[model samples]
Target: MLPAPSSERWKPLRAGLVDMFYYDQEEFWFHDGRLLLRGNNGTGKSKVLALTLPFLLDGDLAPHRVEPDGDRQKRMEWNLLLGGKHPSPERLGYTWLEFGRRAADGSEEFRTIGCGLKAVAGRGIARHWFFITSQRPGAELRLLPDSRVPLTREKLREEIGSRGFVYDRAADYRRAVDEHLFGLGAHRYEALVNLLIQLRQPQLSKKPDEKLLSRALTEALPPLSPGLVTTVAEAFRGLDEERDALRSLADAQQAATDFLGHYRRYAKVAAKRKAAGPRLTQSRYEQLGRDLAAAEEAFTAAQQQLDEARGELTALEEQRAELEARRDALRADPAMRDAERLEQLRQDAERKEKAARDREDDRDRQASQVRKYDGRAGQAAHQAGTARDKLAEALREAADASADARCAQQHRTALA
Candidate 1:
């Protein structure tokens, strides 16, 4: 197994085919960033590699780039239609390559890039679309709803949804894939694709043919950009012209250096002759430096005293501010007197309410006593009426007794 190209960056994880060529659905996984197909010719190894690698990256259905033998006769449409072996009049297929990398947090991330081809029996390639996605097919994502049937372009687009984009144009698809996978611009990625195609040729290392090897390398090598070449030539030309002027200036500088060397010797001798007077002046300067140092010490002491005084003044100012704040607070004490007056009024009102409640209780008791006396007076009036009725009956009985006795006496006299 080959070592991984890089540990941090994404590398090819697998290539897949869906209803393309002889594959219903298949995957070819890479081991350590490399995959080797070990099968005899006619087993569709080259076809598998051609469809997945440079073709998937570039979305180039050109026969030369899509085929290992550089055969212009072959077409991707034929692969999709299975070279007319199928009974259907139309067909669609997919070819994809998955790239993977280890994240910093030890998780796995993936990107899948592929092209969808639609082919008609006689109309060649009807339409094609390319897709790039972060979703991994056969796991989090599915390119085929059923095990055998591949997804259509519309379904694929819906399936990927916001996780990816479906590209209508090959150039746009190539740009997206290049930016996501290779981190290269269009021109450089094209060169890289060309190199990949050259390296993937069928007979790269089978035989010791120097001519073939030379041709492969020559084709794999990117052609020098004309603009870049011109820019480099102009830069070299300018440097070459400047080199002569630089050499002339260097010669003049050497002449000036020689003259300066002689003048320096003369200057040193004159400096020695002038040193005695300066020595006397240097002693005086030292004395002045000591005096200046003493003056600076005095100034620093005064500055310290001034700073201490300013600090004391700041404290006094803060104390004054606090005193003013207290005075302002004391000025608001009249409001407290008003609060006390309100409290007094509230207490008077509460006492008056208590007296009123006591008066109401006394009135209720008096009304209850009056009601009791009225009941006793009604009983006495009823007794008096009974007594008067008894007296009238007694008087009537007495009159009747007297009348009966007189009647008896009259009857006796008549009998005599």
Candidate 2:
């Protein structure tokens, strides 16, 4: 179904008719509501009032309207017999109605609705047709009548779909009329039928109160015994209640098709309880229990995996602590400290050995100087010895001179 549109998206999926196109393929037919059906008195006037219109519109033969064991009524249905007399066996009958449609601005436009019924292959029931789109056969039945403009068959479907609401094996043709043209609801079709039945002048028309409800309405009126009056009123009330119930049931199931779609959707069981109203299915409890069991098993397996991971993590933490303690002890070990201390001791020893070698070189230089000084001391000693010898020789010469002077003095003294 096409959803209702908004301001920006106001294109209606189905449009209303603007006016009636009196024009058909042949010529113009209708002017207004005046339709002349030529016939004699005993022909179909009584049948039209008593049988035909009710059959076409309502698909009902009211029990009150039926006579006692009439051979004709017993043999076959009045409407079905009419369809069997059609020229074609497959086509039970066809009906069409043209109506003026409303335009967007409230002006009149035109549209035609066509319907056909075909008998089911071997069954007594007839399947109705639906005109879903304004295409092909739809175009053939519905037309835009203008004298100058010629018609062309371009883009249109040859026929409607096979089945809609598949379980709804009704006179499908009637559904199209019920939904699009006229409806079978209290406000629409039934009310209209009541009015039509009222139109029959009581003096001429036979089979009054075709449905008990009609007579029931009148029974409560005029002067009557009190007990009888109460009974009549009760009957009228019951009849009204029954009619309302039937109308509500129709509204629930069939009438909402265009708006909410098929009846079966409403009858479905809900998948979840949280959802608003469409009740639950009765047969699937054991399957639901099996699903719950599978879910619980999956959850248990996940929980076990989590527990195992936690156990492995605890072992890993303990192992890491042991490794950390070992590393700290290695850092504090004697060998490691000794290795650093040994490097410092080696550097200090190398410095002390270099100083000792420098002291030994200085000693050797002083010894060589002492040897040179010793040689000079020996030369001075030799010179001193020579000087002493020269002094002694001079003293001796002086002594000898003194001795000769004394001898000369002695000789002079001897001459005196």
Candidate 3:
């Protein structure tokens, strides 16, 4: 009996979709290990697959949404290269796919994968890259759409390596998708997924013609030999010049169309102005004439006012001259000049009288003080003269007593 598959060898299935096109969200579960969607024309099957076109081609989430979702929050859009329209000039919306392994126990193990396109501003394009979630429970499979961790080339390589989706930038994310999903070393898995989309399309998956089916089969498989790829690549090399020429022609055509449109718009405006020029100039001339008439009226009134002002000024000058003559006559009057001199003489006499009164008062005060000092001096002299006479009489009496004492001493000596 064949050994039952172990969990390590479990196949990864593309289980569900969320926020895809107008469906907004749709979930599916495995039925006999397969889920098929069917509808008539104009349903969303093509639109849903278009969302996966970027990833099937090269693991891009597409640069935008494949179809409009009424539930989408952002309004911005990009003219995407791969497919879809989405917001963000850089870092467009994330595309996520969850891979799960179903078991008989009715339990499914899931590993969620999501990525975003990074805008290359200089190139005016974007490229696909993996996202490490910014929210904690760090960069695991399941994360909110908006949650993101800053990641770049080497950082992403290490992350994918750790996630068992090892890759290099040369082979890029295709290898990672193959490794993580199909356990393949090459990117045939991506090409196969693209084939699956076409299989669902009524246009490509119609009633099979035998030879055409054979051709499709050949295209489905990768070339068995490296030399086949080399030959194909060498043949494609010759087409590069033609492609570049076509691109250049397209660019030239676009530029010429833009220039012609701008020139036409400018010419229309110029023609309108030319048509209006004569009327505008005539209206301006009429306005200037009105202004000129008003100015001339004002000039005539000013001239009359100036003449009246000159007459008033002349009268004022005559009045000033008469006042000057009156002033000169007053200056020459002898009576007026004498009255001025008499007033000066009266002021000088009053000043002299005031000086005489002040001097007489000062002399009277000094004389009174001198009399008081002289009376005190005379009384002191009289007392001193009387004291001297008393002293002189007392001295004469002392002299006589001394002479009597000396004579008595001599009489006593003769008696002895």
Instruction: Point to the candidate with the largest TM-score.
Output: 1
Q: What is candidate 3's lDDT per residue for 95-192, written digit by digit as tens?
A: 44555566667765555445543443334334545532211122453322343433454555454454334222424656545554566556467557
lDDT-better candidate, 1 vs 3: 1
What TM-score, over all chains together, does every model reach? 0.57, 0.28, 0.35
lDDT of all the models against the reference? Answer: 0.73, 0.39, 0.47
Question: How much lDDT does candidate 2 score?
Answer: 0.39
Which tens-of-lDDT digit does each residue in 1-416 have in candidate 2? 21121122111122221111111132223345233345886554443334323333343334333212222443223333343553333323333334444555665443334333344334543554323332322344333334322221221122222312111222453454455444444345555544444444343245445554465344323446799889999999999999999999888877567556543554343213222221111112233335445544554554455455455545545655665575566557575467666465445434543443443344344344434433444444444444345434433443344343344344335325
* Model 3 TM-score, 2 decimals: 0.35
Q: Could you tell me how far off, in angstroms, the CA of residue 338 lies in candidate 2 after the best superposition? A: 99
Candidate 3: stretches off by over 4 Å: 1-32, 53-91, 102-108, 118-127, 131-170, 187-201, 226-416
Q: Over all chains combined, what TM-score does candidate 2 have?
A: 0.28
**Best-to-worst ranking by TM-score:** 1, 3, 2
lDDT of 3: 0.47
Error of model 3, residue 35, in angstroms: 2.5
